[model samples]
Target: MSAPGRRIDVCNGDADGLCAVVQWRQIDPAPAELVTGLKRDIELLRRVHARPGDDILVCDLSMQRNLPELLRLLDEGARVRYFDHHAAGEVPRHPGLRAHLDFSPSTCSSLLVDRFLGGRRRAWALVGAYGDNLSDVADALARGDGIDAHRRAQLRRLGEAVNYNAYGEDERDVLIPPAELYRVMVRHQDPLHMLQREHVIGRIDALRTADLDQALSLGPWREHARARIWRLPDAAWSRRVGGSLANLLAGQCPALAHAVLRDTAAGPLVASVRAPLRAPRGTHELCRRFGGAGRAGAGGIDALAPGDLAAFVEALEAGDWG
Candidate 1:
């Protein structure tokens, strides 16, 4: 028989995206073309050159941003299964497309895939959830699913390490490309096994510790009663640490919203905004004002003009988070 058409798996490079695809492939093993990029590379769908009879699986990336490409893929006679938690505008009604999407602030794409798989890989799902900074939700799921505290912490650390590996201005800053990481990931049914047997996890954990330590040494560039902002220079370290630092600061001061602004080489700022953990709202609202979009709890602006940093801070400061 002629070789079957290609099966491509495209996803965001973060832990949530990786774990989601990991779960799916674990349940249904197949050889597929893997397309993914760093955390900031959300428009990944455009990279796919799918032909008729090809199969595509997209995870953790935004449907809103990839709508046009999605429509085009359907027109080309490909079968696409999309799983995501990001903002999805109107979903097209196409028989070839199978969409599993949730825009709720509490959900992540991995958890959605876990739901689809009937919790066969709950451990991996928790890892993805923790990586997305849904600590509380992941913890609750762990508890409900009978995962011991020790195992839960291990999963959390693995999640954080996997997530850390996905950051950086580009692939060079990351220790391993996510596609390669996924190949290593799929070989094991349990993530902890990967942690115990593989050197990759150790390398990632060490990098995360180093990046976080550097981030901790810096103080807030601007501070207000309800919000805080940290300005980081355009460097590999800053790009690697930006989102993780925002999560750290939010955890340290649950009542204060946090924004980590990394100066880009193009003279603009890429901002990661996290609403107060105590009140996880208004972040998406704030980012939307500046031409960015994300969930309510965590959102970002891809490029904030130099003149608008002050205005962005003002909006975060003045917002009614209650």
Candidate 2:
């Protein structure tokens, strides 16, 4: 195989994943096809049909579950570059594929991309870190980079806004699909400009914060294990806010694992689980059991019907983790 004339970029739809590619494309200035989906759709590589010598770039998606597809792509002569902070499983020694993976609690795909690009677009990376709630890390990076507190706050708000836009059962529930949002983001090399020029970030924040206010007014889920279980009505707003709610609750009570659930017309409840910032392992295994997916500290589900609710509660209550 030779250097690629065709290029494809695949990523998770979260702010970090999309932003990483934004920075990369901004720096490199290339017209590549984008392959992405909802935040939960990490197996995007399988959907991409690339020929040998096609340049493929993967960002923010996990390698642990997509090794076969990735290896096949490499074997078929696609030049691949992977940037992620999730478990890579068995890393391969392949000349066609390159990887930059680091699973630090504070690291996100954007920062990983920032590192791989030597921080050429550090500002956008700051926004991605903030969106991922790598607060201290984002603050450190932003502050050290001569980004004032005002700008830092702006980035944090923008991060939350973009992240909020990603929560949904499907594209319809969200204000905009992740791919559409990515298009808007890619047009701007700097997130700050997007924050300043577009009302998108502010609108997202307003919607999310208002929802959190309502969820909080409902009362705590429990005092046990320093966790709060919030039950919400099934609606687009609930779907959008669940992730932000989990983050808001967990941040307010760092020792508490936050489980935000939305009742659905059918199927198990839709849930968002945030490990106690202090105890990231608490809800990881519990979610995995009910056909839900998540990291040890943070992750969520599309749905968990009524029958599964009891079991979901049991696992949460079990608190059976190191």
Candidate 3:
């Protein structure tokens, strides 16, 4: 008799990705090889190697970015199940692939997984929604689940802390590598229990708070009637704080689009862009003009030329985000 093929899981290392995997694994309880990395590592599919008859699970990574690798895996006879909320340009028709993709501004990969599982792990889904900066949606879901206000706050913080930990340029800049954090996270069925039992959550939250505080002190680098932009030097703290800072700014000033640019060791800049919360649209289109892609509400550029800063600002100021 032949042995069963390997089970491989690939996902973004952010809260939504990790929580989606956690929910699936909790229900399945099967051993699988996990491939994940920092939030900036969007091309994680390139690192995966699947064999014929192997089972591959993907979450939260952009299908547009990983299309080639996904096609290769399918051609190699591996069955893949994908869950994501990113902008998928064109989904190929393949019998070996099962895709769950939703591009709604208010939903996330975790919530999709929760819906797939019939809400068996709704609390984890709430944490992921909050981490993805969908507080209003998460709150509504929590209310439906009968979660009290205090517990809702706890889930939000937990989600934010977990999401914050995934922002670094590399694993060294983060308090804990996301894979290690996932191991700790998977052991707890209840996110609230993890918050109470683990000191790591507190440690990560403290570091996030400190980094956000430092980033806030250096006010906006550029501001316009419709947008605000901030620039950060290439440092460990700045690398760790960029995405979280952008999210905070978006929440604080929902009337204007926000851009957070961090200097990279390379000559180019890395950017996080968020559309105005009041009218979340056009971010993906805006980023695509500069060779980046994401959902409508949020997008990022891995390497934006320094020379294009003015053009980027001008575009932001004139963007039809609604």
lDDT of 2: 0.80
Across residues 226-321, which tens digit of lDDT does each residue of candidate 2 receive? 467888888777777887888887788887667888888885678888877776664545766776665667767666878878777767766644
Distance (Å) between predicted and true CA of 146, model 1? 1.3
Candidate 1: minimum summed lDDT over ten consecutive residues — where? 1-10
Task: Write down the RMSD of all candidates, one decimal each.
Answer: 1.4, 2.5, 0.8
Q: Against the hidden true structure, what lDDT does model 3 obtain?
A: 0.93
lDDT of each: 0.89, 0.80, 0.93
Stretches of model 2 off by over 4 angstroms after superposition: 1-4, 303-308, 318-322
Which candidate number would show the highest TM-score if scored against the true structure?
Answer: 3
Q: Largest lDDT belongs to which candidate?
A: 3
- Which lDDT value does model 1 have at 59? 96
Each candidate structure's TM-score, on Cα atoms with residue i matched to residue i, is 0.96, 0.90, 0.98
